[model samples]
Target: MRGYAIRKAMQPHRLTLKVWAVAGSFFGSLCFVLFQGGKLALMLFVIVSILSIYLLLGKWSGIRKTAGSRQLMNAEHETTIEAGSSLNVSMHLQIPGIWPIPYVFVKERLFHKNNTEYTYEVTLVPDWKRRGIFEYKTHPLRRGFYTFGKTECVTEDIFGLFEHTGYIELPQQVAVLPQIVPIREWHQFHQMMKGTNHHSTTTRAVRETTQINGVREYIYGDRLSRIHWNATAKTGTWKSKEFERESLPKTFVVLDRHSQGYTEDEQFELAVSVCASLFHYGASRSFALGLVSGGAASQFFEPKHGQQHLKAVTQHLIGVEADGTYPLRRILKEYVQNVAPGSFVTVISPEHGESMLAVLHWLKQLQLNPCHIFVSADPQRKEHWLKSLKSAGFVGYAVSSLAELPVMLGGRS
Candidate 1:
């Protein structure tokens, strides 16, 4: 591959001396014979002979000089940049003296992972002694991995009669991450939960395990094991431990990875932006945030807080793709079980399928606070689904567009 690219870059001008020389010689020879040996024929013969000799020797030497020096010419470039960013490039030629190339062509081929291509070309000053610096910037049309293949340098003879091109084996890459937008906070996510205070066992990790702050009437989902036998026997009523709110509460943002979900690029991207924004807000609020998604390439990040944690989540979100084979409900159900119960749960999905409905029902049964966000949900298609969720007392938000996400989120605050 390297050799092929280099060879292509080193190709000469489209027009060659041999072709023009041959035509000139042929016409000269034919005219000489047709003229029947006159002075004009002699003059034509002399001119043709001189032209042929110069073409053969002079042009050959020029080609050789370029071809030989090409080995010493190196091209390099900085490859990575954001989707709409710039690149810096440099090329060095170590052939001694400032050789004048009236027109030196440098072209680069950029290929996206989607098999689409972008070609960039530029002309350099012929008077270069050692190095040339070029700044190349472009706005990529789409997001994905981009490859910068070999740089092709086309150096032609002084007369511009022929071109000698040499390819520089410079292979680089640039990754354009997906465009992320602010999602703010899920409207009324925390307020809708039964309890306004976010509590966890760690709040009093230093306190005695036997020290139960108080007993709350046991809900159906409360751990059967948590039933305080002493209290139950004394009061003739089921009771459970209720810990105080922790210093830092945790929220699990589960991105739906169901294979059948988010089939559309636009909808999926919007969903991703929502997740990313929620993570951003979590970091700002100093809330320990965790990410959960399931598929063949499932990614699970335990609830964490701080700048480093935020960076980790952002990096993961940048590369996350909705190609999971599992359903959102399955992914959420599995992930939620591992996280601390009685904590906050947020599900972001573009699909409003039965799987989500089942997950919601299960979450309520477990007494886990649940918030479902519909990404780019169409009113006509998801109106019934939204109505049903509301009727069940589960307040859900259906964001028809990205612009509405912030408005709805801010309103809830």
Candidate 2:
């Protein structure tokens, strides 16, 4: 077992009231034996003193030795998982000592980004080698970054007179990715931009070139001509050469994080899900995707297509919170320089007032195709916003949950 640095200042063995009472009785019996000269009293006092000393010293010495022994603890869990899923964790503890321990109490704590903490307690009975293993499952977790706090192992003597505690620090975290609703066909973009001159510039599908970009695992439908024989022979698996594609159409997803726009946390989560779903759709079709979150700390990513870029975007969404100081109009105006002309911009927010409409108009004037996706749970509000956006010649979608996104974008659920 690996050695762990025990705490320098171990708590001294605690003597409960019973120990003090026994001491007082011994003293009283000794007084009686000395004053009254009773043989039975003297004998009882000697026996009582010896037994008390043996019990107290034995427990104290055992605990002190156990504290200094080699100890190690490890936790196993998934580093990342989808939102609304349960997380399972396994804990293993090793303490090398011969002390007879009745049981060890394990306390676990999980901390969320919002400072919410969940605690679990369990009893572990160590084997002869003083090693213990435990497993636990958490309730369904929401979308966010979660971390495990220090695990506390507490053990006490059989009589419960003395207790000792050791801490195992595990620096582990899990990222719960925002839920993504699969989109079969995204017709809103092309349908709204139809008849516009910029429609010709939009990329509908992946157009491959002869230039080789990289090697990837061979798909079932890949042509034999695209196979990389050298890589396949060396790796003992079919590999296919990936060719470079034509310039992809730039698509930017702007997420609104203004606190006033959302009445509850669920609304903002739905908006985030919408943004993530769009990114997923764009990535699968080879579109250069970017993300712009205008919150307390604004984040901007230029339009790019790659697995690394997608991973970075997903990591950001995992820890995002609604703390924006500015409204949608101001946020767009601040970051307008990063967006390119003739590019598609999708603004996801719950606000659908004149200010939002004006921003969309301004984006159009700047030669950017802008669309609105209003996130809300109220049907009446959604209806009003969709009608207003359509009248202003913009594609708009209303999504209350991830399940409603596919059908709203002209795809079957």
Q: CA lDDT, every prediction?
A: 0.63, 0.77
Q: After superposition, how far is residue 79 of candidate 2 from its true place, in Å?
A: 1.5
lDDT (10s digit) by residue, model 2, range 1-413: 12332332222222445567767877887787888777787898788787666555544433333321211222124478878888777777776556567898888888998999999888988887777787777888899988888777787766676566677777678888898988756776645444343435543223567778777667565677888999999999998886776654567899999988889989898998898888887676556888889999899988887778888898899999899988887888887765667788999999887988998999999888898888989899888888998888888888888889889887332
- Candidate 1 residue lDDT tens string, 76-126: 233334333444444443322344445657787778765778888877654
Per-model TM-score versus the true fold: 0.65, 0.77
Relative to the unseen true structure, what is the C-alpha lDDT of residue 159 in candidate 1, on a scale of 0 to 100? 53
Error of 1 at 185 (Å): 5.4
Model 1 TM-score, all chains together: 0.65
Clashing pairs in 2: none
Superpose all Cα atoms of candidate 1 onto the true structure and report the RMSD in Å to 1 decimal. Answer: 12.8
Query: Cα deviation in Å at residue 348, candidate 2?
Result: 1.0
